[model samples]
Target: NVDKAWDPIRIACHVYIALHAEKNEIVVEAETDDDCTTALGRIRVTLFHAEANERTCRARYIVEPPPASYMRKEVIGVEVESAEIAKDRLDRRVKLAGPWLTQKEKEDWEQKRKELMASNEKVFADHLGSAFINLCALNSSMRMRVQFGNIILKRYRTEMAKPGFAFDKFVNMMGQSRTGADFEKMVGGIELGFKLIHKIHQSPDMFCPLDNMTGKLSDIKPKQKLIYRKCGNVSFRLEADIDITVRGGEYQLGENSLYKEDSALKKRLDVEFLAFNSKFDWALEIMTQERLSSNSIAIQATAQDLLSSATVEQDVMDFPYPTLGPKRRLNGKDTANIHTIFQYKLMGTPYVVQILLARGICSDVVGYCGASMYSTNWDDHMGPNEGEICERWKLGSDLRVLFPLPPSTKQSSFATGGQVVDKHEGFRAFLAAVDKVQTFLSEAVSEK
Candidate 1:
C-alpha cells in the first residue's frame, strides 16, 4: 500500500546519494525496479514516470484536479459488444433446429433461449461492471502516483534541508551542498525527462508508469541529446545571406566612388589589372561603395521552448579537420589549389577557416564552383547561368559554406533560438571577405 503515513526516513533512504555511509553496512536500497527505496535507478524511473504523467496530462494536481477517465476509453462499448455476442450465440443455437421442427421442439427451444438470454444478460452486466471497476482502479492508481510523487518529493526536500551525519559523507563525496537548489534540480530533471520522452515519441506507448516499469522508455538510449533540456526562453541571432548580386544600378554606382577615392589620394595613382578581364570593371567599381539597409524589423520572444540547448560551445581542439578532396586533374607543372586560412573575430568569437575566393567574372568559374573539372571534358558541371554562378559571386553556402555547424544540433527554439538571425554579423563577415578579395586584387594592381 502506498500509504501517506509512510516513514519520512524510509522515503529519504530512497535517495541514492544518502546510501554512502551504509555502503559497508546492509541497508534497504532499490534492489528491484519497483523497490521504492532511494535507489538511483528507481529515482530515475520515478522521475521518468512523473514527467510522462505530466506530459500526457493524465495525472491531475490535487489542488484543482480535472475530471478523471480510465485509459480515456468508453466502458459502455464493452456492454454493447457483449450484448451482440450473446444474441449471436443464441441465434446460432436456435438455427440448429431444422425448418420442419415440431411445436414442442419450437416451444422448448424458445424457453431455453429465454433462459440463456437471462443468464447472458447477468454475465454481460457483470463483465461491464468489472471493466468499469478496473477502470476506476487504474485512474486511482495514477492519481496516487501523482500525489505520492509530490509528497515524497516534499519529504525528500525536507530531509535534504540539512542532511544528518549519516548522509553528510556521501553528499560531500559527490560535491553536492545538499542545498534547496539541488533538490529543485532533481525535480527539474523529472520534468525535463518527461518532456523529452514526450517530444522524441520514441517511447510510443508511454503509460502512467503506474506500475513503475520502463515500458517503452527502453527504446531510448543515453545520448548527448537525452541529457539535454531547455532551461531558457526564445532568442534570435543575426543571419545575413547578403550575396554580392549584380544589380543594374552597379553600372552607374562605382565610377563616382572610385574617382572619390583617387581624388582623395591627392594624385591620380597608377593601377593596372593583370590577368584580368574587362567585363568585371563595373562590378569592381560598384563594390567600392558601401551597401546600405533601409529597412527595420521588430521581433518578440516566442512561447515554444528550446528543444535541446540554445548555446553550444565548440572547441577546435576536440575535432579533426575534414578530409580534403583530391584535385580532378594534377600534373608536375600544375599549381596546387591554394586557400588562405583567414582568421577573424566576430562578436568576440574568433573564427579561423580556409578562405578561398573565386572571381565570378569568368564564365567558367561556374564549373569550378559547381564541382566540375576545368578540363575539356565536363560531367557534373552545371550551366554557367545555374545559380547565376558566372554573373555574381561564385561562392555561397552551396559551394563556400561559412561556419557550418557540427553534423549534430540541426536547429532549436523550434528553429528560433540556435544559430539563426545572424544577418548583422553575416553581412559584416561578407564585407570582410569582400575586402579580403579586394585587398589581394589591389596589391596585384599596385605591383610595379
Candidate 2:
C-alpha cells in the first residue's frame, strides 16, 4: 500500500509542478490495432496559484504515518502466522501438479514466494523486536509522544482514505510471493491476488493505485540508442492556426503565429506529447513534417525497434489465442507481436498498432480500458498463418498502454479524492477532480 500510494503522490506533485502555473489543454488519439476505430478526446487543465499549490502539496506530506498503525501488535502477529500457513498450502499444491510439468519448465514457485515473504517478515519482525525492547527501556511518555505524532500527521487521514489502501498493504505484506524476474512472470499471480482482495473489499477504485504502481514499476528506462535513433517509413502532418499552405512532407512549419511558443493551442499540444511519452516506452522521432489542409502539424515515424535484442521469449510471453473477428470479446490474455505505426498530435489522430497472431491466437479488438484482455484494435489483414511464419512475437499488454494522467495543480483535491476513477476515466477524472478541489479550497480560504 505504501509503495502504491507513493507513485501517485509523487506523480501528482510532479505534474502539479510541471503545469507551470498555466492553463493547458491536451488532445489525445486513442486507437486500436485495426485502424478501423479511434477515440478522440480533449482535456483542459487550469492551474490556480500553481506555485502555492505545489508548496501546499509538499507541505501536506511533511509528516510520516507509522506503518500499519491501525493494527494491534497481536493482530499483526496472527496475520504473519496465517501467511506462513498459506504459503505451505501453496507449496504443496504446486508440488502436486509436478506430473504435468515439462523438464524445461520445471521450477518451484516457493523460492520466489519466499523472497517476497522474507522482505515483509523482516519489516514486521523489526517492529516487534523494537516493541519488545521498548516495554522496558522506554517510559509511557515516550510511547505517548510517538502515538500522538502519528495522530497529528494531517495527511494521514486523507492518505488512508485512498481506495483499497488497507487491502493493498495486506497483500504486499502477506499475499505476494517475491520473485526476481520482472512483472511479466508475476502479473498473472499478482492479478489474481488483487482480484481476491477486491472481491472481499468491494472498492470501486480498489485496484487503481495498484495498477498504476505496477505500470510505473514495470516501466523500463529509455536506452541511449532508443532515444534518438532513426526510424523506418511513417507519415505525419504539421498544422497551425494561421492560413498558410504547407506542402506535404517538404517544409518546416515552425515560422508563423500558429507555431508560436506561447500559443494556447500549441501549449495544449505540447502537453499531449508529454503525456503520451510518459505512458509508452516508444522512442519518438520527428521523421518529416507535412502540412495538411486542416491547419495542423504532424510528424510520422515507424515505431523503431526500441526493445532490447534479447529473444522474444525473454521479453514477452508467447501464449496465443485463436483468431477472431473484430467484434469478438477476449476471454483471456492474448500475446502477439505488435507494430506501432504513427504517433500523432490531434484529438482525432489515428494511431495504429498491428497485432501479428500465431495459429490459435486471436486479438481482442475492443473491451473496457482497465481490463487486461483488451487489444490494440486489429488490422483487417492480420492472419493466423502469418503469426507462425513471423520470427518476432511480443506481448500485446506491453503495447496497449493506458492514457497519460498528469496530476492536476490542486494539491488537496487530488490528494484527497483522486481514486474515484478507474483506468479508462483516469485522465479526465484527474482534471475534473482537481478542478473541483481547487474551487472548494479557494472558497474555504476566502471565507476565512
Candidate 3:
C-alpha cells in the first residue's frame, strides 16, 4: 500500500556544472592493457538545473573523460536567511575599521601602553649603553665619566628587560632620587649579581666542596689554597697560600699570619672582600690609595738618595780664650764644607719635592693653595663624590683659572705705539710658572 501511493520528494533547485581545461579534452586512441581499456571521444561538461531560469546559464567544459564524454556533479549551496545572519558571517570574516573599544578605557590603555613602551625602551637602551661603556673602559681604558655613563645605559636596558618593570618604572624610581645615585645602586646590584652567578658557574668547586652526609668539611685535599682579596672595585680569589709576616718583628703563632686552609675563614674573607669591592667608586678609591702609598715610598727613597749625594759645609768665628782681649777668626774648613754640602742638599731637595708634588704627597700645599694634593685626591675631589667639579669649573670660578689672558692683544697703529708682543705667550709662561711652583710644593711634601 505504501509503494502504490508513493511520490518523489522535491529537491531544492541549484545550478551544477563540471569544469575542465581544453587541453585535457583531447581524445586518445590506444589498445587495452590487461584489465584496463582506452576510449576515443571528446570531453564535455554536464550541467544540472531544476528550474527553467537556471537553464539559460552557460555550462562549463570537462577536461578529462572516463566511460562517457561528460558527467554531472551535485552541488549544495547555502542561501542567506536574514540580514543579521549575513552581517554576523561578514563580521566574522572581515575586520571592521573604527573603534570597538570604550572612550575612557581606550584612551587610558593607549596612554599607558605608549608610556610603558617608551619607558621600557629607554631603560633597555640605558642598560645596553652602560654595558658598552664598561666594556670600553675595562678593555680600552676609557674615562671614568664615559664609563659611568655607559654603565648607566647598560643598567637601564637590563632593568627594562625584567618582568613587571619598564623604563617608566625606572624613571619613576629615579624621579625622587638623584640622577647617578639610583643608577649607581642598580649598577652595583647588577654587578654583584653577575659576580655571584659567575662564581657559581665558573668556579663551582669553591662553593660546592666535596662533603659527606654529615655536612662536615670533607677529608679531600684541595690542590690550591683560595686567598680572597679585594682589588680595585672587584673581589677576586687568588689560588695561592700567601704568607703574611710582620716586618722586623718576632714570628708569633696566630698573630699576623692568615691561612686559607681553613675553609670557614677563607669563606668569610671572600665575603668581606666582595662586600668591600661591590661599589665601583669604593673599589676605585682602594686602588688609588694603594697606588699613592706605593708612590710615596718611591718618592722617599729618591729623596734620600739625592740627600746622600750632596755635601755640607759651615763657617764659625770663635771668641778668644777666657779673658783674652778680642775675638779671633778661626779656619773652619769642616764647617765650611758642611755649609757647602747643605746648599747642594737644598738644591737637590727641590727635584724630589717636585716629584712628590706631582704624585700628590703634600697636604699643606693642598690646604694653602686649594690645589689637588694627589692624583686620587684630585679625581675624588673633582668627580661625583664631592660635587660637580667639571660643571662648576666650566661655568663658575674655575673658568677664570682656565683663561687668565685678555680678549685682544692688538692695539690700533694710530694709538700709542707700545710694544706689540704676544699676550698669549705671556699667559703660557705664567701657567708654566704656576706648574713649576706646584711641582716644587708636591716634591717637598713627599720628602717629608
User: Mind giving the per-residue lDDT tens digits that candidate 1 earns over 250-292?
Assistant: 2111111001112111111111111111111101100111112
* True-vs-predicted CA distance for residue 439, candidate 3, Å: 52
The TM-scores, one per candidate, come to: 0.15, 0.16, 0.16
Global lDDT for candidate 2?
0.21
- Comparing 1 and 2 by TM-score, which wins? 2
Tens digit per residue, CA lDDT, model 2, 204-246: 2311222232332112121111111112232222221111122
Q: What ranges in model 2 sit over 4 Å off?
A: 1-302, 306-448
The lDDT, on a scale of 0 to 1, for candidate 1 is 0.23
Instruction: Write down the worst ten-residue block by lDDT for model 2.
Output: 142-151
Q: Report how far residue 179 has shifted in candidate 2, in Å.
A: 27
